[model samples]
Target: MTGRFVLQNVKTINGIAVDIILENGKIIEIVPPGTGIGDKIIDYKQKVFVSSGWIDLHVHAFPELDPYGDDVDEIGYKTGVTTVIDAGSTGADQISDLVSSYKNSKTNVFAFLNISRIGLKRIDELSDTSWLDEKELKKAISQYGDFIVGLKARISKSVVGPNGIEPLKIARKFSADTGLPLMVHIGSGPPDIREVLNLLEQQDIITHYLNGKANNLFDEKGEPLPEFNKAIERGVHLDVGHGTASFSFPTAEVAKKRDIRFNTISTDIYRGNRLNGPVYSMANVLTKFLYLGYPLKEVIDAVTVNAAVWLRKPELGRISVGDIGNLTLFSIEDESTLLQDSEGEKRMAEKRVVVKGVVINGEFNEC
Candidate 1:
C-alpha cells in the first residue's frame, strides 16, 4: 500500500481544480492542475470531484457477529467510505478480535465500544444493566484507547428493558472518565428523549435523530421538541443514523423546512439493512439527504468533515499536504435514479453521486 501517486485534474467540493500528490501514506503535496508529478499518475482527465475520504460514523461491520454483521470492505472501500466506525458491534470480551481482524484491512475500522461487556452478543445487550460492567469497560478503554473511539449506549425500551436510563448514565460516566465521546441510541424510549438529550453534553451524539416512531424529533404538529432544540443549541450533534427502522423522509423533509439539519449522515448499514430495502450503502443514505435539498458541499461535509470532527478523529477529515492520503474520487451522474428512504418514501434523484474509486494510505482502489 506504500507508493508515490498523483491524481490529476480533479475538482474539489469548493470548485478548485488541483492535483493531489501522495507518497508513502500521506499527501505530500497539492498543486494546481497539471503542475505536479509522481512515480505513478492517474490522469483523471474528466472533471470528477475529489475530497477527503468519506467516513460513515454509524455502521456495524464486524462480520463475525450474526445477522447484523457485514464485511468491513463491503461497507468501506466498496462503498466509497474509507473509514467506517463499527457502532457498538463489539464490547470488551470481543474487542481484541475485532481490532485484530481489521488490522490488515484496506478500510480504516474503529468502534465505539458497547456499554455491555457482551457487546451485541444478543439483540438486546442492555436489557440487564448487569451486562454493563464498569470494571471491564474501563479496562478495555485503557487497553484499546486508540481503537475504541467512543462508548455506545442504546437507550431505549427494548434494549434497556428494566434498566431505563441507567445504561446511558453509565456510558456518560465512562466517557467522562476516559475523556472520549459517547454515542447514545434512541428509539421507543422508557428513558424519554428529553431525559436522554438533557444528559448529553456537547460532544455526545444523538443518533436516529429523525424516525417515525412515537418518540421522534417532532411534536404532533411537526415541531421540533423544545428539549431537542435546546440540546442542539447547547452544541449537541444530531446524527442521521439511517438504520432499518430509523430515518423517515417526511420527518427529515419537515425538519429541513424547520431549519433542522443533522451534523453527520450515516447509514447504520449492516447485512440486514444493506441487503434489504432501506440503507443500501452510505452513498444511498447520502443521496436521500441530497433529495431533501441539502447543498452538495454541505452533504459532503456531513459524511466527511463533520463526521470526523464529532468522532474526534480530526486526522481523517481533510485533504491537504501532510494529511493522511485518504481520498474518494466521485462524480455526480446527472440522471434519473429512484431513491428511497427508510420510511418507503421515494424520490427521483437528478444527480446521483457515483464513485470512481478511492486512495487509501496512498494505494488507489477502484470501485
Candidate 2:
C-alpha cells in the first residue's frame, strides 16, 4: 500500500494558491507550483477551492437506528465533510450498539452521550426522570469513553416535560464526573435563559444559538441577554446546530451585529431536518455565513479549525504537514439563492459553493 497523492492547482480560502502533498496518510508537504511529482495528480486548474476538510460539529446520521436514517457517510462525502459529531442520536443504553454497527463500520464518528436512556428513538417516550438515569449514563461513558466525546442534554421545556432543569443538572454532574464537555440544546424552555447559561462553564457548548420565541438567547426586550455574555466570558462555546426549528434569521442578524462569534459550524443532520431548513451540508452553512457578511476564510475556519479545537482533536480540520491528509475540494459559484432560517425567513446569497471532492486519509474520493 502506497500512501502517496498530489493535489495541484487549488486556491485556499484566502485565495493564495498552493499544492498539497499527502503521503502515508499525512500531509508531508505543501509547496508552490511545480514542486513534486506523484502517481496521482488532481489538477483543479484554479476552479477547485481547497480548505481543511470541513467538520460538522453536529449531526445525527445514526445509520444503525431507523429513526435517524442511514446515509451519514454518503452525506458527509457529498457535502465535503470528513468528520462529524453525532449529537445525541443514541442514548446511554443504545450507544454501544450504535457505535459498533454505525460508527465503527463507516466514516469517522464522534458522539455525544445522550442523557436519555433510549436515545433519539421514540420521541414520545423521551423526557425528564423517566428516560434519564445518570448511573446508566456513567456506565455508558465508561464503556465508550473514546468514541463518546461529550455529554448531551436537551434542556427545552417541551423536551423536559415538567422535569425542569433537573435533567440538565444531572447531565452537568455527569459531564463534570467524566471530565468531558457538555453540549446543551437550548430552546423551548421555561426557565430563564440566564440561569441556564450560568450553569455551563468554559468549553461547554450551547447549541441552537439563533432560535427565537422559545425563551432562547435573547430576552423579551430583544436585547442580548446578559447571561449570554457571561457564558462567553466563562469560555462557554456557542454553536450553530441549525436544526429544523433553530437558526432564526432575525436573531442571526442580531448575533452578527452583536459580534458574537461561533466556535464551530455544524449541521444537525437528522432524519427530520435534512430536507427542511438550512440543509445538511456544512458548505451551505458556510454560504449562509457568507450571506451574513462573514468572509470565506472566517467561514472556513468556523467549520475546520474552530470545530477541531472544540472537539480537542488537533489532528483533524487542517491541511498542514503531518496532519491528517484530509481535504475538501469545492467550487465557489456566484449564484442568486434564497436561504431560509428557523423562522422560515428567506435571505438570498449572492455567491455559494458546492463540494467537488474529498480526500480522507490520502484517498481522494469525489463527493
Candidate 3:
C-alpha cells in the first residue's frame, strides 16, 4: 500500500517555498510552487513554516520508565520530534532491556551508554570504582552498537563532587577506546572548566554549552573560558541541552552576543520538566534561540542536520529526497514571552513558534 502526502506552499527559514511529497515513508520530491499532487495535501498557504524534523541529541527519556520518566517514544511522538538520543539514562545492566523491549517498539530511539551500572538512579557519582565494569560495557556496545550511539558522563560539581578529574579521565578513555563520540554534560565541575574541556577530543560534544553559573564557559571577566574556545577550535561540538537545571538567560544571551554558534540544539527533557516552564518543545527551544539573534535557518539546522551529524546518523535529520519522510510544520506566533533558565534568569521573547504536525516515516502524526 502506497501512502502519499504533500505539504504545499510552506515557507522555509531559507526563504524558499516548495511542495514536499512523501511516498511510502520516503521523501520522493520537493517541487517548486505549483508542481505536485498527492492523495493528501496540506496547503500551508505560506502561513506554516517547514524545517527538517528535529533530533534532540541530549534527552533523558527511556522506554521502560513511566511515560513521565524518561519515556523516549512518548516524548518524541508527541513533540514533533522524529528522533532522539537518550543521553545515558540507561547503563550496561539496563541496556539489554532497552534494546529488546523499547528500541524495537517505539519512536526512533538511540542511547548513550551510561558509564555506570545502575545508570542515573539512586546514585550521584557514576564513577563508583566497584561498579565500573569495562567488560560489561564492551559487551553491551558490541551487541547493540547500532542503538548505542555514544557514551554519557555528567561532569558537574553536584554530580561528580570534588573527585578531581578521574571520572572525566575514565570517560575520555572509554570514548577513545571504543572509537565513539563522548557526550559530556558540562556545568559545575571543580577541576576548573578549562581543564575539563581540554580533555574533550575532536567530535566530542559539550552539552549545556550556555549554562550561566560558576564553573561554566565564562570567567570573572565575562569572557568565554579559554578551553571553551580551544574546544571549538579543535572542532569539538557545542550542544544546547536545555534541561530543567541547565540553560540560563544570562548564558544564552552572552553566547549569542559573542556570536558563539552551537553545533546542535537539544532539550534535556526528563519526567519532571516536560510540563514545566522552559521545556515545552523543540519549537520553543528554536524560538528562544531565534530571539537570541540566531538566524532562523541556523536555528533549524541546530536541531536537525547539526544534531544528526553528531549521532553519525545522517539520514535521520534531513528531508532530502530518498531520505525517510520526517517532516515538521510550524507557525510563528506573535506574542510576548518570558523564559527562565536553570539559574532563574528571566528573558523575554516577542514571539513564539509552535509546531502543528509531524510526519515520521511518512506516517501522519499531528500534534
Candidate 4:
C-alpha cells in the first residue's frame, strides 16, 4: 500500500474514461484511459463507473443503542460509502464515546449532535425538558468542534412527547448560539408540520421530507404544502432520510411528478432496517431513486456533490486532481432488481447500481 498507484480504465458517471493516479493519499493526476503509469496498477478495464466517494448524511452508527444502532464501518466503506454522518444517535453525554468508538474504523465519521443531552438513550430523548441542557451541549460542541457538523432535533410527536414545539424553540436558540445548522427529523406531529417548518431557517435541513406520514409535506392530493415550498425558498435543505418507516414510493413518485426533489439521499440505517427490510445499504437506497426515474448522475450526486456542498466540504464530492483520493467504483447492471419502500410497496427496476470497490484515501478496498 505504498508508493504510487493508478486506477486504470474507469469511466466517470458521465461515461468519460479516465485513469486516476494516486500518491500519498491524494489524487495526483486524472488522464485519458491508458495514458497513466504507476508503481502498481489496479485496472477496472472501463467496466466500473467511478465518482467521488459516497457520503450518507443520515445513519445511526452508535452501535450501542437498540434497534437504531449499528457499527460505523459496517455501513461505511464496506458498502462503498467512505463517509457517514451519524444523525443524532448521540448527544452531549455520549458524544465523546461515539467519537472514540470510530477512531479505528476505515470510514470517515461526523455527527449531528443531538440537542438533547441524553440523546437516543431513550427514543423519547426530547420528552423531558431536563435533557435539553444547553450548557452541556455547548461544552460538547466546544470539545468536538470538528466532529460536530450541526445540531439535530427530532421534532416528531413521539420523540418530543408532551413538549410539543418547546424543544424546537430551544434548538433554534442553540443553533443561533452555536452557529451550526439544524438537521430536524420530521414525522407524526402534534406541533404540526407547519410549526416545525416555520422554526427552521436558512441552511437548516429537514430530513425525511418525503415520508408518507399523515403529517407529511404533501397534501391528500399529493401537492407540496405551502410551508414546504416556503422552507425551500428560504434555502432550507431537504434530505431523504429514508428510514424504516419514512420512505414512501407513492410520496416519492408524486414529488418527482410535481418537480420536488431531494437535496441529498440518506439511509437512516440501523441494525434492524439494515439487516431485515428497507434501508439496507447506501447502494440500495440509491437504486430506489434510480427506479423513481431519476437519472443515474442525479442519484449519485444526491449522495456525493450535493451532500458535500451542503456539508461545506467540496473536496469530498468531486474527482479532481490534488484532492484526497476518495472515490466509489460501481456499475449499473442491466438486470431486474426488486426495490421496496418503507411502506411495503415494490417496484421492479430494470437496472441496479452495484458497488464493486472504493478508493479510500488513495487505498483500494473491494466492496
Better of 2 and 4 by TM-score: 4
List TM-scores for all candidates, in order. Answer: 0.96, 0.94, 0.94, 0.98
Compare candidates 1 and 2 on TM-score and give the better one: 1
Candidate 1: which stretches are off by over 4 Å? none
Mark the regions of model 3 whose C-alpha exceeds 4 Å error after superposition.
Answer: 63-68, 101-106
Deviation of model 4 at 276, angstroms: 0.9
Candidate with more favorable, higher lDDT: 3 or 4? 4
Compose the digit string of candidate 2's lDDT tens values, residues 1-367: 1368778888888887788888877888888855657777778877888988888888887776665655677557656888888888888878877777653433577889888888878652236476777788888877888898888888777777767777778778877788988898888766557668979998899999877666878766667789888889999998998877788888888888888878787778765556554565677677888899877788888888898888888768667888867788998798998888867788988898788888876678877
TM-score, model 4 to reference: 0.98
Give candidate 4 regions above 4 Å deviation: none
Backbone clash pairs for candidate 4 read: none
**After TM-score superposition, what is the CA distance of residue 100 in candidate 3 from its true location, in Å?**
3.7
Query: For residues 1-367, what per-residue lDDT tens digits would candidate 4 score against the true structure?
Result: 5479888999998999999999998999999898899999888889999999999999999988897899998999999999999999999999999999998898989999999998999999999999999999999999999999999999999999999999999999999999999999999988899999999899999999889899999988889989989999999999999999999999999999999989999999998998997888998999999888899889999999999998899999999989988899999888999989999999999998899999887778888
Decoy 2 TM-score against native: 0.94
lDDT of 3 by residue, 144-256 (tens): 89888888877876667657677888888888788988888887667678878889989888898888768889777667877788888998999889987778877777777
Clashes of each: 0, 2, 3, 0
